[model samples]
Target: MNGCAAFCSPASTQPALPLTLAHPLAHHSCTMFFKILLLSAAAFSATTTAATTYKASFTQYGSTDTWGSGNCNVASTACGFYTSPGYSAAVSQNEFGVGPGAGAGPACGTCWKLTAQTDSSGNNLSNAGNSIVVQVTNLCPASGNPLCAQKGLTGTNQYGANLNFDLCIDSGASNALFGNSGVGLAVGSAVQVDCNQWSGEVVH
Candidate 1:
């Protein structure tokens, strides 16, 4: 049956009606179809535009001190290393509360954009303009350690550590985000964080 005839089954021996744009019912159906298509496309665009943004703190780490332990021994599991000499690899605390972790486990190399920094007093730091993107490489502070609790993380399996990143000082470029060889920002300094993009293998 043609478009018009498809909507109505006439009993008489009638030839299939030739569908035309001028047919009111046919035009209404086509209009509704296009409207539904446009609405679906709009909803998809909204979802893609909605990215997660939050605030977290950071700590700095060095190459020799932070590597060869936990999951870092496996290069594939290690936080991605920057090739530049001064550039250092970075690790994420399992307690950041964004990804999956049970004391220690792969976080699927999730990447984040460190957009701005603030001091413990909530003052915006000079380096707020320096945004750096880093991937999660290693689980930090061990599970159930008292130090993790001291950092305002109050859950078992290292779930509560307030620390968000272990910036690799050896990864030279990343240090600039924190300031002067990573010494500019002291440990426990608060920073604004945003979930800019996911990279590598993300779990869920």
Candidate 2:
């Protein structure tokens, strides 16, 4: 069993016994055991591969693309409103898809990043200044897709429609009092509120 003879002999698979071969028989048993070990390893590898999930979410900062129904104490085309006169840019009536590209962002869609702030009333949540968490699922793939393996989600607005997430906001923050994650999107932290993918399942 220790030397090469046990492995190369033509009678390696059988017992080349004078009466009952010792070394060759032991080698044959070892070969069978090795095959079993290999098969078990293959099975474990296949199981691990089958159990893996390959979906991802991205976070980016954005605002409503267009204004809906609002009269913020600002110019004709602006978004949320700041309680203080300072940081007027922080406030606008526009939706998540319509902000005029804040903080090194795309005017339309370079990266639909998550804004870690909250908004409400078709707008970001006020004062609490938390970002929204929208979870878009599935994101059906298609040829010529502008977004594939991209890093974030984008807001959409063609008409006065609510261009929301593909996946519903399954759950949300509870920063109702301006601390410990607000009820909606956070202002400066990441939230999962955009959808490259979506689920058909809907519930109010």
Candidate 3:
């Protein structure tokens, strides 16, 4: 027989070849994996959009001793596991939408960016263009106290609206951010603030 004839075989005598199909379990797992990925992305988007911006005012808190154990009242411990410097603040219990000594206030340990400080007359102060960052370390602006109102805060109650921040004078934050004027944060000084739930923590 010729070489080509010898190498050829009848269709019926051809060797059998194995076939493989995708496993049902594997297919299911792959679909589930992709579903989880999409769900996580959606959750992250929601968190990013949750940051809120609102009008607020500022005042000076007394000595650092008022920090109550040095930990935020909400956390009940020094810095409440936070190790960053200047991580101190006093948020209005009412305005922040939480009860006093609740230790569950969302504003606790939150970071705030304060700027555009102006007097009751709406005239910007010397540090009008400057901004300062501080952390929430205490609860303040007690209801019906007029803490901000007495300090020259005009208009509605800052505590009622959760729009007040009583920064610690010992932190030197007043002079650093509001200028070294003989008076640190003159009473009734108005300021605009931006607060975020996660901006206060520092790794270093």
Candidate 4:
């Protein structure tokens, strides 16, 4: 069948064929096939598109945002340097690149913009939408955090999140993003973004 002729009859002066008259099901079949193709294309696009923003869980740690000692023993985290004056985070084991036992990985020094959305228990937060950018300075060992246990590219935590950011409260990020409610766990979204003018270890 001439698909172009069927779909673009106005482009030509030739009269359109009356497929419905000649073969009752021809036009219907063509329409159905085109619909199927469109649906398949949409599905393929959805699957091929990599996720840039991820649903994530955020927890606060009461530790100094100093450069050195802690999760990453070197002089300033696994990432090797402190961010700005007080903006650092410990990412999940998988995303931290190196395994729990290692000090660094590919994700070290990566910057992420995190926005608080809800509590760890899924309750909507009063301070939802507050956001902050932080650099990955440490690793949230999966062995220590049950929520960080999710592994591999498709791994997800109990909340169906693939990423976890444990913000250093002393860094001021938690206070800014969650106010007094930043003590424990919170739910949010995380997106990798350009480091821009951020002063920190070279972002990977």
Candidate 5:
């Protein structure tokens, strides 16, 4: 009749509860889950470590105009993806990894994942987390911008970025990368990825 006796037999003896053993398949599944988690963590760490951080800004060029006059005129782009309809960027000389007057730089046609972090004013941007992949089609000469100078001596930009990326506003991913303004500087990080990762035409 008491709380303990209610559940016990009339003799007030307590019965032992049955013990259930875990199935072999459950152990296997748990091990697999942990293995997958470790692999995913490693992949994320590798991606973060492999990315070369850079400062991002914007440039303007005709997307389809070949006869336009400018360093990055579509037809005269370093990588020759002039008419390609997709994101494009002008990387600084240090990051571009090419010498003066080189027809096509070593960094040309490389794909980069650019994620904005802040605007020229150093304020965190609402679209800061958005990222867009772009193909390198032009060079932002170190002579033109100190931020583009060779490493070691180039130093960081006004926004404190080691490298500078002058993105083209007319590129296909402009809205996604730069938002509506699309005309000012944006601080961001850059990662060189496989060109195949680009969703646009990649002509090297």
Candidate 6:
């Protein structure tokens, strides 16, 4: 007979309404308080956890000219791509571990082969894989002038151990790009056309 009486009445008298089971909005104060408590707990948990950061840095030398095609003239020529049509750069990748020691512990490892694509980026395409390294161990003591190379692997012929480092360029990949940019093609991201130029192409 009554509207509000039939809805919020005692459970014993009613056959039970289907709408009450799926109700999202709460008219009562208790439901609202429960939601607030849940939210506060979630916020506290997020604030206490540490965040992981990672970056992949790389340096590549692109080979353009077959031989010495460009003249040494610094004026009109300006040692440009016509002379050196490739580029090189340093890339870095970092991961956050479970600790506050600041980059100390068992040590992580990473290895990379230089990948190249024709006028594009993402997933090294075009088959010109020239890997390179930042070689920064010697420069470590020199202040903010080191590289993102394999840790514990520097000086002598230890480039093989560079697999532990987050960034690296293998001998095979570098050889391909060292040939001809117009032939093998240019990798998009780290290799800029003008900035990190390279010398002669890899001879066949």
Clash count for each candidate, listed in order shown: 9, 59, 8, 2, 0, 19
lDDT of 1: 0.46
Q: Which ranges in model 5 have alpha carbons more than 4 Å from their true place? A: 1-49, 54-73, 150-154, 181-183
Model 6, residue 97: C-alpha shift (Å):
11
Residue 31 displacement in candidate 5 (angstroms): 19
Residue 82 lDDT, candidate 2, scale 0-100: 18
Give the runs in model 4 whose Cα sits over 4 Å from its true position.
Answer: 1-51, 64-76, 197-204
Tell how far residue 59 is off in model 3, in angstroms: 0.3
Compose the digit string of candidate 4's lDDT tens values, residues 53-133.
Answer: 988988766545344433332345666655546477888887887775566788877788898888867888887888888
Model 4 has an lDDT value of: 0.72
TM-score of every candidate relative to the true structure: 0.56, 0.22, 0.52, 0.64, 0.63, 0.22
Q: For residues 100-133, what per-residue lDDT tens digits would candidate 3 score against the true structure?
A: 5455455555666665456544566765656677
| CA lDDT scores, all candidates in order | 0.46, 0.29, 0.50, 0.72, 0.66, 0.30
lDDT of candidate 6 over 90-151, digit per residue (tens): 22211112123233222221112233343324344444444442221101111231333333
For candidate 4, what is the TM-score? 0.64
Say what the RMSD of model 4 is.
Answer: 7.9
Predicted structure with the largest TM-score when compared to the true one: 4
Question: Which pairs clash inside model 3?
Answer: 71-77, 71-78, 71-79, 89-137, 95-162, 151-187, 151-188, 152-188
The deviation in Å at residue 99 for candidate 1 is 12
Scored by lDDT, the top model is: 4
lDDT (Cα) of model 2 = 0.29
